[model samples]
Target: MRRKILGIALILLAGLCLCLSLNQADKYRQAEKTYDDILEKYTKEKKVSKKKQDFVVDWKKLWKTNKDVVGWIKMDSGADYPILHGDSNEEYLHTDLYGDYNINGSIFVNADNSRDWSDPNTIIYGHRMNNGSMFGSNKKYMEKDYLKKHPDFSIYRPDGCYVYKIFNVMVVEDGTYPYTYQFPDKKSYIEYLSKVKQYSYYDSGITVPDARQIVTLSTCTYINHVKKRLVIQGYIRQIREYKGMVQKRKINILEDNAFSKTEMEDTNDKEID
Candidate 1:
């Protein structure tokens, strides 16, 4: 009887382990559902708002649901994720956009960067899940072919849409000092770009002159150690007015080839969050 009882206990433990594994898998599904719901609601509201002037997202409604939401991120390769901003990088590191505690935390910007997307280097973070959600596709940037094929992604703000071209992609140690927003002078900013290009996986042959905005997408990668990270940086190539809808629309910008040169170009800069 003692042996039989021990065998039964072992079987029950196995069942419990299986259930826990299933629960973890379900978390990714839940994250997907949450994002879909928000997108659906945004679509509906966007349609309704077209009749009014100043076509922009219903920030009032979005804030009511989650004050952390700052803007939307969309990739040419079809990675569309909502960008959330919290008091600190840690706040949304483990929390979803809806305040739910999930391992697949919402895509978030570092607290060091401005919430308005005004910073010269706006770095965004997301988990690198095995299931290829969030920034999982970030690793593809390492391939020169992939970079050439899908060279651009865009950030949609309430005021307008900004298109960025992938200029450099790197796999660097976590907390790399060169990736921070602490650059004081224009010379330092140019030097930072040089370091990133020097360490990039591919030369990319793309450069960001001073005065142009940049965005960096970062994710975890287990390359010899868990602390290694994949970083993809891009410079703003174009900007268009939001046009009161989420679909692709175009507008004129102040200049073409804004970042084509190696020197600072004039910009009618404005603040955003």
Candidate 2:
């Protein structure tokens, strides 16, 4: 009789674990759908030339949804999401873009760094989810070949769009080097850059001279359960002014023709369907 009771309890425990796993999976699916909807609503790609294209985000619409929306980040390796700036670093760790609670949190900038992108180094954080959401794909940087193929990513702000070239990919203990926000002098900042490149898994051959603005993408890694973080660092390569007006219609521009005189004159003009 005791043996039968023990068997029944074991089966019940397994059923409970299965139910919890299924519930968590459903939550992730819903979270993914929400992000996909946001991307479709507020972002569109514009053909610059016959061979080139660029994407634009409706910064005005994003801000309207949540004033905390600061910028958007995109990478070819399946990382595209709106960035949020919360009151503290911990605010968005478990909060989604719509301020909802989920294991998959929104990408957020370091609270101590300047949101204007004027700081010497700005650090961005995201969760390394199991289903390759958020910064999960960032782990590919651990392989040098992957980094070579995908060395660049873009960030869009209200003022302009900025491109950053990845220079270093390193794994380190939390609260260690390269997590710093402020540097008292240029020399110290340069030294920090040197250490970043020095400790990288492989040299990316990118430079960060003159302390140009740099951004760090950080995500958790469970290599040995020692609280290691995978950090991908990059420096700004280009900046293009954002001049289009936000409207319901899509904003399309030709690179060869450039912005027309009328468009330049009326920066606030809405797009006509």
The candidate that achieves the highest lDDT relative to the unseen native structure: 2
lDDT of 2 by residue, 114-207 (tens): 7666567789999998889899888988998998888888888876677788888889877787788677666677778877776787777778
lDDT of 2 at 69: 88
List TM-scores for all candidates, in order.
Answer: 0.79, 0.86
Q: At residue 99, give the lDDT of candidate 1.
A: 89
What are the lDDT figures for the candidates, one per model? 0.73, 0.79
Against the true structure, candidate 1 has what lDDT? 0.73
For every candidate structure, what is the RMSD over all alpha carbons to the true structure, in angstroms? Answer: 6.8, 8.4
Candidate 1's TM-score: 0.79
Candidate 2: which pairs clash?
Answer: none
